[model samples]
Target: MPAQALATLNPETEEQDRRASVINELEEDESVDEVEHSTQRGAPNTGTTPANAAAQPDIGILPSGQTQPSAPDTPVAANVDLNDVVTAPESELLAMQLDTLPMPRPAQPLALLGSEVLPGTSARLAWSPGIQIPGLSQPTPVLAVNGIHAGPTLCLTGAVHGDELNGIEIVRRTIYDLNAEELSGRVIGVPIVNLPGFQQGSRYLPDRRDLNRHFPGSPDGSLADRIAHSLFENVIRHCDMLVDIHTGSLKRTNLPQLRADMNNPDVATFTQGFDRMAVVHSSGSPGMLRSAAVAAGIVAVTLEAGESHRIQEHQIEAGVNSLTSLMEKQGMTSRMFVWGDPEPVYYDSDWIRAQHGGILFSEVDLGAHVSEGEILGYVADPITNAQYPIRANSNGRVIGMAVDQVVMAGFAAYHIGTEAEIPAE
Candidate 1:
């Protein structure tokens, strides 16, 4: 019988059994034991099932006789103190809906990156710092489209690493495709933030410092810091929500997914706006733009598409479609977007590393599901003509991985995504 039809036979008992069954499956699986000892934050922790996760609460599956907190009453942008909520027991996160903003964002002009964009219009602005890099006379580009009606300001920033070409294209296609008159909220797109690195075709700033690590920057700090400060204050501060687009760094590639801090009710809810995209639970590292934005009360999430430096059309198309669906969900667009089945939200992830340095080749493609102990790839020594098979430690899906190339010992190779029970308080 269909589960839904069976669910009606004994609703209460069925629900309790369902929750218990999920926990039992996780605890009973031998692979789950291996996952508990593995590294954190690679793809997602492997093992367990989310068979009924879509029907469960966003925070987590609930136990019998327990009720979640009611959704917040105010709009997400009212600057609510989320510290208490985020710190609350995991159960409360299931019901908090912080993105419930009042409709029609109060039709107003948006002044961003030094340009005044009126309602129902679009403009191209420039973002330049007070202390510019040598020979960087040209300012960075910022695209804005102010909707005819009022709504939230949704910001899309790309190319923060300079060589992440896929992000630049994603931002361009998303913004240009939107019609200003049909939009509800303002859409701000910055196609390139690290122009210096872009010009040099490198991932770091001219000083070799990573621009991504200096978020919510200081004007009196290093070159990267100053530029981060300008962008954050001038461009980012005006946003009600932010999606900092990115691709895999170095030679790694990611299945189209979102890295989000699920503890934050606002961020958790905001992630639901995307359609058919996997959600990987991550608090985000310090100094990351997504982390900094969340700290500033903005609902934010990082969208990871493909590998860096290359513009893959399939990745670009997936990103654009997801963004379009998000805008539709957020009421920024009048268009209809039919959403697909909810993608699994991996609560835990870990990266499996190579044991030996050699020319590596993957057996499983990105997004492939692998059983525990399955061979993921082989690391073959070019000089000795010997090969070593790299295997998965737990059952999971490949969410991120290194491209076929020479690898070093301890190189992160495959990222595994798994669903697991959030421990009881």
Candidate 2:
């Protein structure tokens, strides 16, 4: 199926504002893994904010070759920093400030990919009359065109958890701006895939089912199970690739990054095509959509972005740019975004759990660096007010840390990066 013609530009100021206002702080966030960037800002990402997928297919998606930058140039933070200038009541803060930012134009799909090598069969296809959600409903799905020109069917999903809504915004932007004229393959986008959870502003579904844990579900099971089952059989099985987008849980944040099966070259290639974004290896869950896709012989990966329950511009851009980056990699589109060099750090991240239940104090922010045996934070008894320090077990970076001060003994404190084969900078 051919991608429909490009829609006329209808930039949503509010949406764009949402991303811009938050991007600066997020970009400079010390916790995230840094990537060298040529442009002023990084890329965009997928689905709704509520909460959180798939498969194994053959001939994993691999890039023919990677385009290397002249040098790994880490652009310094602008001298006129947005963080220093923008001042507002915390409640009235904006998402991103991208008015002065440059953009990557939509490349002629055929010209960018070289039509000679693109799939000629016109395997483009799309689903029909997608159901709509209740709250925050604008730019209805009917007005949207989710098309795939050729090659394979890929699904970009996000906001399975309500608070994790960055992916949802990313998907929305993709649909609003998709120019079908240059598409080479099928792309299915599920922005705010978990509408019920998203509307409730919670991670779990309205019925309290963890959507990620209920995949390949049963029609006769819980509501989440049925939906999961339907998605698996009806939607997931049809795709050649799957990318799930996410953010850190409430008050938590992640740098723009990807998690996929490193052993599978295809999956690795797809993950790497997301230029300027860190790639982390993961063992997809048995019930996960990534695992489901893997099992179905489809190559899939999880694209993680900034913190949860809040929208950030850089992350949304990161999500969008990553997909487009893959489009460039797959020769599906012509537009090539000039991006930054990524500081790709590999780690088997581990959680630093609170040793004893109490009110807690955290010193470092998410994306901060740490050394082995370093103190992550401290826990204090509420009644007794006894403080105990929690320390790291190994040297690595802090990808995420608890935002709330109150803590429980089992609650995770610091999500620390650990031993992995990080590509040298």
Candidate 3:
């Protein structure tokens, strides 16, 4: 039976059936010691059945698309001191509705990152890493849009690696299109997380550190560590969910897709919510924002789109649509937005590297499906005009590829995702 249909069944009957199944399993078991231990632990004797457990009252939707019962009018977490989080004026809180979704509550003030952002208001807060130059100090911008009604706090962060421009624009547009009065929960956006690297148009910090490799930061550690610690403690720790956006580095472009730890059922639902993008199951590297946030018990996912340093309109638009769809799925907005056709979900992916050094060109675009032994592109020696065809080693879709440019032997040129058949070496 469909999980959605099962969710609507009588809860009492379901529990009774579950108990009966446990009893049958216990009766059939021949191990006396195991049975005695199970009896003492009050454990179910049968292997657990996969069932759609009753959804939490606070969470709005199930993975099966069924709506959960509305929660009672409970106050926000008392532990979250709202005094530091600012609140907007009543007039501003009631300003305008950007969508048709019903508001869950009147706007209320919330505080974050040492600033108070009122309900129905959008504000840009700043964070400085305490690194002062001769006459200049750079402060990273943290954008917040608090909704009139109450809902889970969703944080959208971008440009962790300064040159990843697609995410910066994605976060900006996603927050810009929202109307505070119409929104149900809060949306926090950090468009440029690596200010110094972004200013330099580089992928690493001025100190030559990859800012992304340090998380849950240390106050007494290096510059990167301090910045990470500050953001994690002051901003990320407050979010109920997070979407860390990125782009391919080093002249590579990625198809608009999701790289997430789908092993987590909640994370899997979040990935599936972005209907039109491909999903690559990944736990992510240590110190990554996605990994750290998940470890802190926040549901998080990463969205990779296009190449670094330049904004691709198609990729940006796709990201915005996917995020908006996700908000709608979470009941954070009443907007009626439908995602296009679904994309493939791959459990594994590999990169095809160049065997010879030369100027390069691609025959296929990002997101194109290719067959085993198919010609993907060619590497040409500029002076000699010698062309070498690049072929796919296995059947798969092109999730990422290097832009047309000079290349070196062993340079990763194409990233292919496949469900079966290992690529030929």
Candidate 4:
């Protein structure tokens, strides 16, 4: 064979082939989610599932034997110090949500976490002076920030889904040739929150925990929760602001946008500043890192960049520019951060899903404008090739689109950001 033909035949020689394999691995991992989903659907007691049904309270476990002690034995306290209640034992605090949070022991080589860590200032709480996750050959991620000048604590975390590496790219690039002295506060970038999942290219950790859902996590929950708790407690607790970075995982693409809870009185103000924002209205899901920040009263927002687990230059550029703009917005940096092309299309949006299981064929690109009744996409039977048109029920901009041509019944095929529009010239 000719030299050109031989080169083409060599899988190890092509960088694109490696990337393609990585993408395939991500896709396969998502397939595992489908299996678990199928298990839930097929379970005989699906009604008992908390996901499928409203959770019932354990009324039976209430204090049944307790006598009526409404008033304390010593009914004297008119002016007792409230500090008694304010500064309770960690044991008591831990018991309140005993079953939920991380229960991690201090690393055996507790010294593994550096001995004297400089917890950053209030504004840059997430930027710990220095620490380490022991056992890992890598000099833990904490030390990555050492010697960096104090600045606003801007946390740009990515790949919480493991496969979504777009945000990682943003964080990696922002730090390249960065000058701490030039920054006013701090930038705490956990480019990959779910390191194990990222390594496996899976969404959840090995223990099946969704790190995103476990918020304000306990120091004693699952591994993911523990890590999250450690992260929040040791990192974000001090920051005045946080920006979580993410990409559309599971074969979907989201237009570069901000997903924040417009309903949050504290958070709504900043995330909404951008021109193209997709307000998720999610203050905090139980395990989500962002929600934990929200509860902690930190100004936090999650930015959706692009497709999952891959480095798209435009996406990275968009993310970097957005982060810089956000930093400047908060008066952290002097860098000129440009707003995205097209004034941000603001919206309170929801998903339009497939009603019947079929293959999803999209008619529009993410970020494309659409009218009511427009053919946003079509769901077709794979074997029969019979098409079921998925139309837009309301006028909106497409914030997300399914990357997979195949989808199932009730699968979210498209997400429309309503009340958004291209800026007028």
Candidate 5:
């Protein structure tokens, strides 16, 4: 199918088809092993393990032409008592036989804005803070999937800017694809954080406010503030880590990359967990969710993938795989996930903007490597057919670019990530 045609298809339909195709492919691959162990929902008893475990599939070769690391040896049954395992700290529990240990009893109902979600189940709650028009009194949807086992909570938020649709789909698949019965930690997902803006296909709220710029908001402030406050205080504050998914705004599209404050030890650990995606070290702007979460001592990072207003399948798959890797790194799951390659880390990036208004045509695609003074694209006058070449200013990788379309003078056309740096914590 043509790329344009695929973009025009119903997003929900496309996602369903993608999911089915992935399942079919997995089923056909004899090398892939099925996870046979199952745990009882809402049971305080330790989960049961498969009598005979299956061998994990080989993860193939790394980008450097080396074989990927082999999976860890299957865990042997431990002699420790189930009661001790249940009461032990999470770090110690991870080293023991997890499946053979009993889960800790859920303490209390997880309270939210206007609802309470119990453990061992999922819920779609609503958050309405009394700000509603007559016909559009719809409340913001808050989805939660609490696992039967006791572990850290990971919050996945998407569509902070309403028009960014890739994250919404990423969150949907991440929550839906997870098996709550076998899950260890709790996952809270807010797929569409800016509902009003999403309804109008706008990045900003109706009141002309950028929802993302007003994080850790005030209860008695503007509409954006109230919404931000409700989410930060009621939902985000309870999380141990936050992954705010996003896409390029306006006319730009990004390569699958992660941005976080690499200076912070906790944030660095979380950022490194996305083994297959590129990482850009950045101390996020103040009032941004990542910045606020870090200030509140919650490990946080931002994922930027694809373009806005469309669901790209490859980007979605990348996002899903990154999240899965994160789950494994945090010991939230026992599943063995091996990444294909270690993505390069870039310390700084620069945007190449247009010098004159014209029709823009990109000569290179996202992730293309370019040297200083190389032509990345061209801008041409629609009537006179006069053209001007846009060149890279530094040796770097094309991390982001605008779609082929009419552009104005000084508009951001290409983004280059330069100065590749050693991975740091």
Candidate 6:
């Protein structure tokens, strides 16, 4: 999608304010992650805020919670930093920010994808939409871990865009690091939903359709729709909650944050479970998986991490920590995850675009707080050596930004999460 085509450029607005497009952060093209971004600001909110199974042997776990031959593997990065990225809030504050929702008590076994995942066991199942893809028709890998006790079924979906590697890593780390014996309900993970896209390193399906935009799809529709329908029916329906993970797209990067619909009470409560994670209110696009899931009476949110294509260890670690904290809050796991400082909930956001095409140089980093009219970066024309500064239109933090690279005029240069407000103490 062209950068110029994204912003709803207002002709009446003056030049100073017109430099930044005041779009509802959630409105985005199919090429980018559907969840929009903004600058970050405001006080921390404590209260606010903001699945499934299958089975097989050899690729399955015993009741003793031992790993099988096909257990999900961790990312193969030797120097990856596994430390907690965000600092913990004060002890008193942590105590006040308790789990707002009661723990679910699901005692029955998890039945999914034509197989039963018994309690205290894990399994790697094969899932397919039954669509023929020539040499790439193999069923996608699905990881399921059913806990011994009772709780909610949490589903984690990654690589919805295929090229977003950070989400895949986050899912893998969260699922495989689980101890079924110590868990309450269940965890279902699909690290790669768009298998063809992942294989080809493309963001779209073989039909060039954005798979993320087709959700709760129809079997009679296009290929993307069929696959979406299959996954939604066979996997998503089984989820008590869904975390559709993603990363920045179109040569952009995002701060690790939760894009949720704060209007939904259940979703708002769910957003509070993550520790030290920024929460951005994005009602979501019509066909988006997150919006579709919520419409189907399931609490869902999109976890936007780092950029696509490359796997950044810090982003992966931050995502994993947030998930662990969420599970711990939900009573699904006994892991002693530390709760971090409360991040503000952003109700609005804006995109600061470049006014001139040139080599972009960022003056601020991701998550940097900025006042309105502050210089975010500059675009320097190589031909005439003219430099144009990009300034913020709102007081907020830099939640997303394009990396230092050549960019065309009107490109989204900085996304600020504005109008930050916290839940009452």
**Which ranges of candidate 3 are over 4 A from the true structure?**
1-108, 133-135, 383-385, 419-425
lDDT of 3 by residue, 33-88 (tens): 88766542343446563344432113444566877664455565567666685556
Q: Whose TM-score is higher: candidate 3's or candidate 6's?
A: 6
* Lowest lDDT 10-residue stretch of candidate 1: 53-62
TM-score of each: 0.74, 0.63, 0.73, 0.64, 0.74, 0.74
- As for model 1, its CA RMSD to the true structure in angstroms is 22.0
Clashing residue pairs in candidate 5 are 46-102
Per-residue alpha-carbon lDDT of candidate 4 for residues 1-425, written as tens digits (9 for 90 to 100): 23443344345446356445545644665566664454332336544544321121111112354333332433555887766756467777787788787542221111113343232221112222222345532322542332224444556677777888888888877755355445555555666767677878888876887778776666666676666776777666756788788888678888887777666656766764554345554445655777778777788888888887677888777777666667677766666655654354464577898987877777888789999999987887878878888899888888887885667888888888776432221
Q: What is the per-residue lDDT of model 1 for residues 95-129, given as tens digits with 9 covering 90 to 100?
A: 35534544455578987765689988999988887
Ten-residue region with minimum lDDT total, candidate 6 = 49-58
After superposition on all C-alphas, the RMSD of every candidate to the true structure, in Å, is 22.0, 28.7, 19.8, 32.7, 24.3, 30.9
Q: Write the per-residue lDDT of candidate 2 for residues 1-425, one digit (tens) a residue.
A: 11121111123464345445546545675743443232223222322221110011111122333332322343555568555755565534432444445543332222111122132312223322123353633321211232334444567777767678788888777655556555656566677667667777889877787788777777788877776786677566756788888888756677677877877767765666677776666877777777777877888888888877777897788788877777777765677577667546555878788879887788776667788878878888978979999998888877667775777778887877764654321
- Per-candidate clash tally: 9, 75, 9, 29, 1, 12
Residue lDDT tens for model 5, 1-425: 33444353336575556556545655665642342332322324344532211111323334465665554663556787766535457667776767778766543456766677676778988766556775868988888877767678999999999999999999999898777666677889999989888999999988999988899989999998988888898889989989999999887899999998878877776777886899888899988988889899899999999999999999999999999889888877767787777787888899999998999999999999999999999999989989999999999999989999999999999999985765552
Residue 154 lDDT (model 6): 96
Residue 306, candidate 1: how far off, in angstroms? 0.5
